[model samples]
Target chain A: MSKVVKIFHGPQHPGITGNMSVELDLIGETIVKARTHVGYLHRAFEKLVERRTAMQAFTIVCRICVPEPDPNEENFARAIEEITGLEVPERAKWIRVLVLELSRLAAYHLWMGGQAGSTGLYTVPQWSVGYRDYILDLFEELTGGRVYHMYIIPGGVRRDLPDGFLDRVSDVMDLIESKLPEFDRLFFDNAVFKKRAIGTAVIDPETAIERGVVGPPLRACGIASDVRRDDPYEIYDKLDFDVITEKGGDVYARALVRRREMEQSIKIIRQIIKYIPDGPYRTKIPYPMNWKLKAGETYVKTESARGEFGYYMVTDGSEYIRRMNVRGPAYVHGVSLLEDMLEGAQLADVAMIMNSLGTCPPEIER
Target chain B: MCTDNPGVWEYIANWARKHSIWVLAYGTGCGAIEMPPTMTSRYDAERFGLRGAATPRQADLLIISGYLATKTLKRVIRTYEQMYDPKYVLALGSCTINGGMYWDSYNTIKKLDLYIPVDVYVAGCMPRPEAIIEGIIALQKRIEEGRAEGAKKYRENIEWYKKNQREVFGDEMLPDYTWNFEGGI
Candidate 1:
């Protein structure tokens, strides 16, 4: 047997999904053993939320997942909405769905860039990341910030949609929809991606279930699992979309599930733009600092682009949340699932697997 | 001294460095999400000669994209030390300025410059792609003006930096060889 060469994949690597590292003990480029190292990006989100008021906590929760912040905001809002018996307005519900789907689309675009960039296909990142901007423009118009939309707050959304915002959303949807075929030509159907991504890092359905795999990775295993369909939040139950799934349970399958879901996101947004009712965007929320939630415990999950994102909250009838624990999908997939998958895999496939699993470090550590 | 008065060779080197910046984007926090749009197609930072460098050794610019967790700060220092001289550090997001939204988070460090020299700071919770490109332009201008002397500042004040790093990291501080500038790894 060849002697093992130990290596760290990131906290600083371009190939790494985020600010997390994997320790790989390899022999001839095949990983013999893999261990994950986190806390490189830990901001101790769980601890910080316990001290802040409900309104103050809302602003920070989105920071938990950089690629998809809305899911966190949605889950946080929904958790309180459930715990306190708060009611979101009808218009706010539709707008929240629009925001969630838009963020999901933006995340998938970002994921495509990561997945494609990992295989050294440079053009796909350029195309996809650029297209993601159109959605961001819509977000900026609606929420006034591009990356972190702090719009989906406690009772409802922060404000009403801008005039003609739906029209703009539709236009962006049209543009992104029009470009999907070109992406298909360039990436999904590309021979190079298929050869490299297929059969590399296959997650069998049993293993996927055993590991508590969620989101696209779970669906990619042919299990058809999704939080939106299973436990619908916001207007997700009302919206029509499939839990896009694929067999083979490899990097390509995960990529396909996300790619197909982009259309469903566009479709959902189109429906939202068509069916949304006009009224007060948000119900009256209590004072920002002095609001106390009812003493209760609740768990809420949303289908983030990565998979199921959840927040478990306990309020002791105080202005501050008694406890808020995040169940970010990466917590499962990034650590244990990832280490298991990396064993015997080529050194190169490390990045590919991480992207396929949608392992965001912030979520794992938060 | 080079920060104030650049020799003829220094001017030429700075000119090259200003034009062709190889960025090793250390995605330490949430601000990393904006980097793709900045580097890839939408903003296309390459038009300004800004591109992603795979490793620290090959990089001229280091972007601390958001709040530096104490653990990440150690790695950032190691990364900064591994990079050759004349390198610039561009700090993105308000987190690096004053811990941004993560100020209360125990693990996160408030100011980036306390641990390493920062040449430019682009402030926002997460600065937009345009803002990041503008920050890159600012760094480029600083390089051309011979004002972006972060690496030199780091070398000169390594003691203070190490002290601050040690304070936060306690016994978990990085190995000395990583920051031993005169020893020359």
Candidate 2:
């Protein structure tokens, strides 16, 4: 008989992406079976959203995915707009595009740190996290809240861009671009990272698609499928950028996809800054607290930094939302894909593999 | 060499504990995202002796970053018990204070202090890094003054804490992992 021990890898471990855990049964250092355990971070967002009106629901939706929250807000707003037939202003669309891209950039910066940190590179986290502060500073100036910017709402963004906001965004973009070479030296191009990531937890392209993997992880499998490219949302059709992809579906390939995508996001941001038209940022809605939505159900999806974030809203012609369901990419990545990938992998590579998938536990448990 | 007053020894011990606080990098909720900035270069929580610990046994500061659902609370309680004496629990976000945003949620506990003793509470939907740093500074002050005796308080009223914890967790409560049952926390 073999002695197999079960170890819980999270809900507290620094290696874990969020407040989630992986239960691994190990015979020595090799994992025999892996089970992903969530619910640690679940705040019952769907239930809470149903109890609140569309305007009130907007605030809580962003908390569904903490790391990249703007996409949830965007999806919520777009879904409500689609249901009520509210036309968003032209400039508001561009501003939404800018916010999404900036959120993507900030998220990727943090992911770069996580990917590097998982591989035992301390310098990358220090550098990348420090750099991400500039993006957060820009957010603070624009939205009035660094983390949870409840700016994007049903009618439009809460307010117009602050004075010189675009210029500051441009400066931050330039600063990030300038630091790319140093980032490559410390993280992307580092030999040790490549060696550690190249063959670990490789996913078959066919399985990845069947498993419903989206965003960089899917693109890393040589299948260039992006929500922005396929189903145009916001002003993405007008924006000039490429859907970056890589061949192998390993950690390195995912990192490479994210790295290239960061450049694409920067390019998109630059275009927005140069070409943004001045117009009324928001269209007025009736008294928000008492504003009733028509009876309808619609689903809206946005390409968040992690993957496709979709929200399904059902309004029963009532002031309070009838039902709202969040469809986060983490459901596939954090639970099913994570369990599928962790089997038979080395214990040391658990965190590395999890980070590669970019699983957010709040989204999973929410 | 051994002829030293206990009061002097306590002073030195508290001073050492005040600095070099090893926080459990657990990320209990959404507020966890802010931790990266606070601990990393920008806020540099390390300058004030706050660094991350890999496990509960090695940690002195437990930062419950956001709202604690019942499931997470079970583990948090276990982790809290596993920690050595003089542990400090810094409840981050308004959720922990009184379920700030998720006030009506079925899952999230209203008051974090009910389950685990909190030393400091950084209030915000998700408090910024500056607020987090301020909380840490305040915690250090409490430690230096020998006022941050949450662990001792926990031991003194383990029954009350466990009762509150059990009310939420029910029969599926964590197995007792108490290290010192005779005279220590």
Candidate 3:
């Protein structure tokens, strides 16, 4: 008879993407059953948002997911815009696209580090995290905050681009692009990484779709669906870029999708730099001190680095928000999908699978 | 509690402890993101002898990086207690002090000091890597000066801390020392 032992994987584990735990009933090195638990990072954001004004609520929403916070801000801002029928300026749209793409690049870099780290590759995180810091530097210059921008608001961005900000951004882009070949040589095309990731955590395309997997994880399964292309938001419709996909739904496929998406994001950023119009960055809204909204409900979704980040907001003609619900991809990917994938998986591959899925616990619990 | 004062060996110990602090790599919140950069080449926290320890047993520092939900509070205390003696607690972000942005949230604790004795608090919605480095320097100074007695204080005032911890985690009581020796295989 095979003896089974139950062990808790996280809540403070290094391999865990955030504050989450996976209970694994294991026999030897093979996992028999897995259950994901997440309440550690819960700040009751949905309930907290109800107590604040729209502007104040914007500040808090970004804290939902730390790695790629702009998506939450983007969703919240767009939801309010949709509800109020507010039309953002053309330049603002371009800037929003730029912010979104830069955010995607940053998240991908962080993910690269996590993926590599999970596989016992330390050089990748050391290099990738350093590179990510440059993007954070740009974010600091633009929004006055490194991690949480809170720059994207209902009407438009909070402020205009600083002098030569585009030039600085281009410099960082140039540096990152130059290092891609080195990264490919070291991580993507490396024999060790390929051996570890290629066939691991293989997801069926049909299962991916039925399971509502979006973004690179879904695209990695050969479905050429992207929120930017399928449901165009901001100036994504006007931009020119392809929705990248891979036939293999394993960790390797997802890595390739993200790597190619990085190149695509770079292309999109260059386009924004060239085509951005000269105009007001934001439209002045009426006094925020006592800002009131008409009774309404709206849902807005954006392609965050993880997957789809959607916000469902309701207002009852009051200054305070009536209800706000965040539907982060991690909610699905971290709990249900993680549990499904971890079954029968070797205990050692659990962190690798979790990292590839990009599970952010704060978003799940919030 | 039985130690002597101002000995030459104590100074040597303080200096050695100040130079080598193994920080447990347990990221409690948003402030966790900043740690990667701080430890990496750009900020290089390792240069200051601040390195990531995989478990509590080997760590000398416990950094509560952001807001702590009640659920996490239980685990943090457990992890804190698990660390070896002569430990320090460094609280980061405004969330640790007066609850910062999550002050009104139902689950997040208001003041971190009430639950755990914090040695240093770095103020920011989420403090930058530079500020974090500065906080580390301050902590190092405190260690050298032998003023960082948070763990000692925790041990001395066990009843007060236990009372506060009980208030936060009502019925879900935690074991005093988690590692049980009596439970045999």
For model 1, state the Cα shift of residue A63 in Å: 0.3
Candidate 1 lDDT over residue span A239-282, tens digit each: 78887889999988888998899888888888888899888888
- For each candidate in turn, the TM-score is 0.97, 0.97, 0.97
Candidate 3: misplaced stretches above 4 Å? B1-4, B179-185
Interface quality of candidate 1 as DockQ: 0.83
Per-residue lDDT over B82-120 for candidate 3, one digit per residue giving the tens place of the 0 to 100 score: 887778999999998998988888899999999888999
Residue B180's lDDT in candidate 1: 64
For model 2, which pairs clash? none
Worst 10 contiguous positions by lDDT, candidate 1 chain A: A231-240
- List where candidate 1 sits over 4 angstroms from the true fold: B1-5, B181-185
Evaluated at residue B154, the lDDT of candidate 1 is 78
Per-residue lDDT for B50-162 in model 1, tens only?
A: 88888899998888888888888888888988887768899998989987777777888888888888999999888888888889888888988888877777777878988
Output the worst ten-in-a-row residue range by lDDT, candidate 2 chain B.
B1-10
A265-330, model 3: which lDDT tens digit per residue?
999998888888999989878688788876899988899887788888898889988998889998
RMSD of each: 1.6, 2.1, 2.1
